[model samples]
Each structure stands twice: as structure tokens, then as C-alpha cells.
Target: MSTINTSKRTIGVSFDESGRAHVLLWAPDAKQVELLLSGQDKTVSLTRGESGYWSVETRALQPGDLYYFELDGKKQLPDPASLSQPDDVHGASQALDINRFRWTDENWRHFPLKNYIIYEMHIGTFTPEGTFAAAEKKLDYLVDLGITAVEIMPVAQFPGGRNWGYDGVFPFCVQHSYGGAQGLQSFVNASHAKGLAVVLDVVFNHVGPEGNHLQEFGPYFTEKYHTPWGNAINFDDAWCDGVRRFFVENALMWFRDFHIDALRMDAVHAIKDFSPTHILGEIRQEVDLLIQQTGRKHYLIVELDLNDTRFINPVNKAGYGMDAQWIDEFHHALRVTSGQEKTGYYSDFNAVESLAKSYQDAYVYDGAFSEHRKKYFGMKTENPGEQFVVFSQNHDHVGNRMLGERTSQLVSFEMLKLLAGAVLVSPYLPMLFMGEEYGEKNPFQYFVSHIDPELAEAVRKGRKKEFEAFYMDGEAPDPLAEDTFERSKLQWGLIDQEPHKTLLQFYKELIAIRKMQQPLCVLNRREVSVEHNTEARVIVLRRQHKLQDVICLMNFSKEEQSVDVPVYASHWCKLLGSSDLRWNGLQDIPALVPGELALALPPESITLYSNKHE
Candidate 1:
């Protein structure tokens, strides 16, 4: 519904059923173009069109007016397809009427991406009046902690008002301190009236050098590929089809104007593009024609450190269709089996059988050999497990740590409930960052304000030279400090104390035993299976699904092993344990009898079990 294209070779602020205000701009190296138009003092000129787009219709403009763009009338800027900058990001660009907000989520719908649980917040520290109407007053505490979708993170319009939004630069405005663009269309209509689903997190691979005006609206960037947040977003240049239709119309203006149901994308292997289709397969064939003209459901989910399954494969096989991704090898084999440090790329995840090969393959370097980017990595795809999106405290594994601690400050709340039972009984698609369910002891650091004092001391000497090889306590928090974004917010009064209310009731009893377990809500990776002991550090998995099967066991050791598992057929039962004195643990190992193979395991725990049918 919102690939916003006003019949006049559209580019930015549209309007027309004779209500006027056209305004386009692409700027083929701007020879002239004007608009200024706020409270008008005359300046309207545009007409260049013919493939360099320039437009300008006016009835003195309409929808929320306020404008910019002058170029060659002495360079002004700020409208590389802006929908609303509401003054900042170097000011003016606000004619936002992509059908002005009013969307009571037309019966919202969009679920699948393995029926998401994703939480991943950061609308400025998830709250402390961090706007988007204070994170929609915590969406009923993330739908009472069973969160279905939230994602967020990048909100575009970055620069000042403290960021972490990967320094966004008006990729269709929004973040005028988080409550703009109709406060993200009323936080996606209150997350679709509480059923959830929002996603977002964009950052189209490079465009944040403070208020960057997309190269004055022309060759949209590219000095011949190079990214690390610099250039490389020309996506195959020479007026790259109006910069790939202005980022596939800003990812279909957040699923046709802010009804957003998915878009993670950030860092698609730094989106270089050699053309021949692949602007992420032309944004998945234009969001599959906007989900066949808005029957809803959108999704995209990328974020690649190149374990490439051709970006979630299948677009007639040549790949890049994308529906899911973000598989950091099961959070680097569960943080090197919960004992952390293996150094960069965690030295190819020092085995715990790489967490049973990322639970029977979702990619643990499918191509192998990568002692931290030394070569031969990933590319073996049979993509499943909800096309991969696993997590264990994200925001770049806890704000690219150094001091932004948290895996509950580096392990042990019984290995953070054994890494939340290996990410909610893995079959993929699980995510939780914002205060990780209920253990939020702050520290999601890496804040920013960047009113560029030499880009704020090169982002505080590049985050203390990228965390000077770990071990940080005292000084590293000034990410241009606002008390490091108020010590990275989320201390919602420590969720009623005591192991954060017993890890928020063990993450709401493992998301209510993953929705009353049917092999943990089916995403069928051929009914999964793992089984590893790695010298009694223990691992187990097994799922199944149709008539149920389960089994799960975890224990990444702190000494409490027993092992002998696998025998998922006859009588099992004990569903959900994370070491159980009602989750404050100490032991509660029940049900299991298949030639009674001793199983115990309580130190760093996780249990599960099931059985049924036949």
C-alpha cells in the first residue's frame, strides 16, 4: 500500500488527488531545485524529470509542511526521501502524508518467521521516558513477557538526542527523539493492539557520518565499495535506479506506512551490490509486491556476518529472498559453551561440539575454518529452523561488550538459566535483549550524542580501541556520556528483586513451556536432534514434534553432571526445569525412565522432557 509513488515520477513528499504538494528530488547532481516552503517566502521551482527526477507541485504544500532542499540555489539538503524530520538531522523535511498515520492496524496479521518471540528493544534505553510514547508503556510488559515481536533499535533520523540507532540519518525520518513520525505511527498502532509484531531495525549499510544528506541526493554513495559505515550504499551506482528506488521505498515505508511487521536488515554484509538484481533480491521482489498489495505480513530479517544461506535462499534458487537471518552461530555456540573468551569470532567457537553444531546445523561455519576471519567461512545452506534468528542477549551481544556486561553480567544465574535453555529449546527464531526477559541489570552501553566534536572524539577513541581486548570496569563508559545513556536504562526497579523475580519466573515458565510444547512449537528442522557430552559438559536436544517427543537437557557445567540421556520414546514427562526450587534452583530432577539411564545435572541447568503418543 505504501510504495509511495505519486503518479509524477515520485521521489519524496507526495500528495495529489488535487490536494497538491508533490515535491520529488533524486538530484542527478543537482543543477537546480528548490522548495524551502515552510511558512513560504517563495521558492518552488523543480521540474527537471526524465530520469534525474526533480518535481514540485505545491498548493504551498500540505501535509505537515516544513521543507528543505535547494541545491544550486546554494545547497540546502535534507530530503533524501524524508517523510518527517521535524527539524533535526540538519533540520527541515516534514511533509509526511504517506496516508497520514490513522491506521488502526487494519486487523494486523503478519506472523511467521517461526512465530517470533523476539524482544530486542532500545528505543533509547527501553524507557526512562525514552519516547515512542515511552516504549508504549512497556507494551503490557511485553505482552506479559511472552513477547511476540518488538525488535526496533534503529529509528532513522539520528544525530543528537542520544543514539545507538547505528547513527541513522533520515532514512525517512521518524526519530525526532523517538516520538516523531506520529510517534512511529503510534508505536505501530500500539503494536497492533497488543498482539505485538513490529521489527524495524534498518540502517541500510552506511549513511551515518552525522546528518549526511545522501550525497546531496545523487549518486547515493559509493567510492568503489568500502564499508564499516562509510560509503558503499550506491548499490551498483551511476544513478543506481534512483538509489534502488530510494531503498526500496524505504522498505515499503515500513510495510506500507508504518504498519511494520518486520525488517531487521542492519548490515546485510555491508550491502555492496554488483547489480543483476540483489538489492536484497530487489527487496524481496518488492516485498513480494507489498505482500500482494497489503494482505499484511512483511518480514525481511537480515544482519549478516556472512554465514550466508544466500540470505535465507530461494528466489528461484539464485538466493537472497530473505525471510530470516541473524544466526551468529547460535550466539557463537552459546558463548563458547558458556565459558566465554575464545577471542575474536570466539576463535571459531571452541567446541562443546559447537553447541551440538548449532543444534544440528543452522550454520557453525558451514564452510569452516575461520580462526576469527582468517578465511574460508560459511555457505552450506539447507536453511531451516525458522530460517535462523537465534539470540542470547543481543545488541551486538550486549552492546559490543567491554563494560556493557550482561549475559547476566557474564554468566551464572545458573548460566543464565543455561542460556535460557539454549535459546528456548532451539529450532531457531528466538530473541530477547531488552533487559533480557527479567535479568536486566542495566549495561547495554555504547551510547551517543554526536554533535560532532570531531565526531565526538572519534566516538570516544573508538570505544576505547574496541574494548582493548575485554576486561573493563572503571573508565570505558563515556560513549560521549549522558551518564552512558543513563547507565543504559532498563532497571524497571529490578523487576521486583530476588534474581529478578526468579528470572522473571524463569522467563514466564519458558514462554509457557513454549506454548504447551508440541516439540516446542514446531519449526521442524526434521524434528531436530543433538546429543553431545563433550567430556561430560553435557548437551542433549532431541525435539520431534508431530506426536511430541521433546527431551532437552543442557548443563554447560559448573559441576553437577550425570549424563546418559537419549531415549525419547517411552515415558518421560518433567517438562521445564532450569534447576527448580521454583526456578531459584537447587534441583528438581523428576520423570525419566527408559532403561533408567541416570540424568541428574543441576549446576548450570535446563531440563524439559515430554513424550506422548504411542
Candidate 2:
């Protein structure tokens, strides 16, 4: 189905009387136009019409038909087929009937990202099989821990059996090895069955080097801007309208066809778009329109390093209207709280005071000048206390390190318990890396499997060089090693191991308490206040809603420190502490006794307590 250009650069789909597909390719340059089809010699010598145009009408292609066009004499190109590319990298261009696949979640609305908890996992390591169905088995565990959504890492088809899906050339197709098309459907279906919404991480900045065939067809990218990975996508230049539609349609397709609840746009700051209405703004409008028409809740989440709140601000305010965005301040708070000072970015936060500011205000660097960036940052969120996704450990914070050690590896078992308490209780949405609950020991190294040896070597060398000073006492893990991907897999058996099992249990308990306690889930930032000892780097926060009051504390030093209720409360109950040594699973300390219960903060430990009487 195809239609003639209406106005500007717009084209619509159309069908003939017999349901045959017809398209009018606007390119008038070719001396010949051949439709590359499965069994037909579609090399129809097109009649040249007025105004430099060529038109072709073909019998309606089947759903799985791979069709392309040979324009002029030397170009084999994907259809202006008005369908989608299921196999990124232009593998076999597919002619799709949008109505072919029946989606089951008809009455399903997307889960709200606000006050939600997310678990980010990579399909390759989620299970031994590393398929969608294999990962489905773990959905119950996430639900059991009160996680609301499962954000799978990029699933666009990449090379070989495994790689972080970032370097994928195909933005539309599901990864073939990780259960491809059907696997994705099953994964989403199973997740919805368990009441967990699915959020996908999408990369729109640039396609990888291998398998990228868009350039062979048109001006899909431009050198007008640059990104660390490659040339920036041409968003506002010539043929930029086509490139924009390619990605915008891709996003709508994910929600409309696949039932994905939300999308975390990967590193939006890296995406350079200079259009009058930025790409993010257009994507938001298109997504919201689809949601209204379908009556489903769809969220656009930006994983932005820029502290600009306009990304999450409502559309009425001339902002992007994204439902939520990732907040790195919380990560920095937890990072600082544990005395883990790995500088570079850490230079912005060398003191516990910065951590407290983040917890209270939701932005530690809220317009303050920074030494590392040497610039003021983090414009205040007009509406503070919003529930944006905050994490103690994420793929970048871990994988970008010398060795991708999780927060569990960086801090003590006790500190792991403290980190969970602080995040869950804060007035922000909480996120956990796939195995952060049990503290799995695998490192997420930067790995790729491009066919070109030079590109692979460059990636490996680049990673090694970037983290030379950050590596933990040894050489950077070999990015090209078969063992690298293998080692990245989570050890499910760790759930039964000592200390690991205890921490996993601790996570479940903490989440349960958060859901059950009104004050633990406080919704407003102004309602939460922080006071900590500058000398000892000891901290305590009090959160009070209409129903109950909660206190959270952390000791960022080797020696234990004690503090009276930082608030004017005469008596404070110790609801929980990291190093009651009860994290052993054998020891269990009852909720703290009211009336100034003594606190013992261990080295790099965090603790939580409830003001017994609200």
C-alpha cells in the first residue's frame, strides 16, 4: 500500500482495488527501476511521468516477503515499503502487513513510571538460554521484590550470538540470537502476565559500523555533528525529514505493535538534533497521540546526563513531556555515602554533604559550580520530589569502570543493605541492575562482535585506554575474549550463596517495608529532610508523611558513629541498621526501641530507622 507525495516530504500507504501494493518513489534519477522480489522479475520498465517521478504497482506482497528496489542500474535498496525493518542492518528487507500480528494485551495500559521500581537486564545474560522465554522465568522474582517494570537493554539485532545491543545496526529488528521476533513477543507477553510492565532502552544517535545499509540508500547521516561512537545522525539537515520519520515511526511501532510500556531513550544528550521542534519534542507528541488513540499509558523516559528538567517537564511548558527521566544524583549520593571515591565524575562529590543535598533536594549540583565540569549544573526541577528512576548501580557506572564491579563489590555486605534502604525510602523511583539484589559478581565489560577486525580492535583498545586509571589492581578485561561475554552472565546460584542470599533477602524485605509504610514511600521532596555529621561523615534523614515518620542514616567511615535524633524528636526507634551483623540471615534485630536507641554505624555502612511514634 502506497500513496503519492501530498505536501513537502510526506508519503502515505495505499492499496489497489485487488489489494496489490503500489508505491511512487520520488527519486527520478534512475534509467531503470527493478523491484527485487522473492520470485518475480519485477524489473518493470517504469513509464516516465511528468515532474521527475517513477511509479510501480505490484501484487500484494506476503507478510514475510523480502523486497527491495534496484534504482537506475546499481543500487539494491529496501522498500519505501511503508512497513518496518524487523532485522536491523537491512538483512532481508521485509514487506510487512501492519495488521498481520495479533497483540493480546488489548485492555492493557502501560504501568506508571512514577513511584515505580525498575530492573534493567540484558537478555544475553538474563538466563542460561539467554532467550526471551528464559528471561521470562525471572519476572516473578522481580515482581516478588516489588519491581514494577523490567527494562531490557537494547534488543535491536546486533552481530554474532551476543553483544551489548548498543552497537546494533538494525534499529527496527529484534535481535536474532536473543529470540528474534517471536522471542520478543513472548517475553513481553510473559512479563505482562506477571503484572510487570516492559520498558525498552532505544539508541537513536547513530547506527554501528557493520550491517548499516541506510547510507547505501540515502543521506541517513551527516558529518554536521560528531559523537564519540561515530558521525551524528543527520536530524535537521537535507533528507533529515526522512531520517526523523525512520526513528519516530520506529518508536510508535514498538508501542503500537509490540506492547512495550515505555522507552528509555539512551543518552539523549549525545543525540544532536537542531530542528525547530527538537526530535524529542516530536517523539513525545507522536507517542502521546498514539496513547490517546489506543487508551494505553505509554511513557517516554530520557537517560539524560544533562541536568535540565525540561526533558521531564510537561508539554504545556514547552518541554519534551517525557513521563520521567533518570536522575544520577541519587547514584552519586549512594556512591558518596559508601566512601567509594573513584574520581573524574566523582570530583563533583568528594563529601557526604553532597549526598545529603541530593537526597533532600533531588539535585546535589542544583546550579552549583563544579570543579570537574568546571560549570554550574542541574537546573532545579520546577516540581521537585518527582519519582524519576534513580539507581545505585547501572550498566554505565559499572561497565565503564576498570572492571565492572557492582556496588556490592565496591562496598561491604552491610553497605549493600544500606544502599537499598536509602533508595527505596527516598521520594524517587528506584532501579536495580538485573542482579543487584543478590550482588552477583560478574562484570559488564564493553564488548562487541563487528565483522571488521579494525573496528573490533579499536573498541577494545578504546575501552582499555578510557579506564586505565580506574581498573581495580589488574589489566582491563579482554574485550575480545569469549570469556568476556561469558563472565558477564549473572550467576543465579549466587542467590543460594552466603552473604549473597542474605543481601537478596534484604532487598525483598526493604521493598516490602517500603510498600507497606506510608512514610517510606513519601511522595514529596519538601517532606524529606537530611542532617548528618560533617566530621564523621555520618548521616540521618527523616521522612514524614501524614501517616508515619521514617529515619534513614549512613556512616561513611571505618569507625562506628552514634547520633541523637537529628530532628527534634526526643525518642527515635531504630527500625533497621546494616551492621547489626544480622545481615548474616542468622541474626535478626527487631525494629529499634524508641527513646534514643543506640546506633553503631560500621565502616562504609548505611542504616534506616523509624520514629516509633508518628
Model 1: residue 316 alpha-carbon error in angstroms: 7.7
* lDDT value, residue 76 of candidate 2: 74
- Top lDDT: which candidate number? 1
**TM-score result, candidate 2:** 0.89
Q: Quote the lDDT for 521 in model 1.
A: 73
> Which sections of candidate 2 miss by over 4 Å?
1-33, 38-57, 77-90, 95-99, 467-472, 566-574, 585-592, 595-604, 611-614
Looking at candidate 1, the ten consecutive residues that score lowest on lDDT are: 1-10
lDDT (Cα, tens digit) per residue for candidate 2, span 342-430: 56777678567877877777777779898888887778774655547788888988887777777777777766777777778778888
Model 1 pairs whose backbones collide: 406-409
lDDT of 1 by residue, 238-340 (tens): 8788888888878887777677888998878878898878888888887887687657768788988888777788789898889888878778888888887
lDDT of 1 at 261: 84
lDDT for predicted candidate 1 compared with the true structure = 0.80
TM match of model 1 to true structure: 0.37
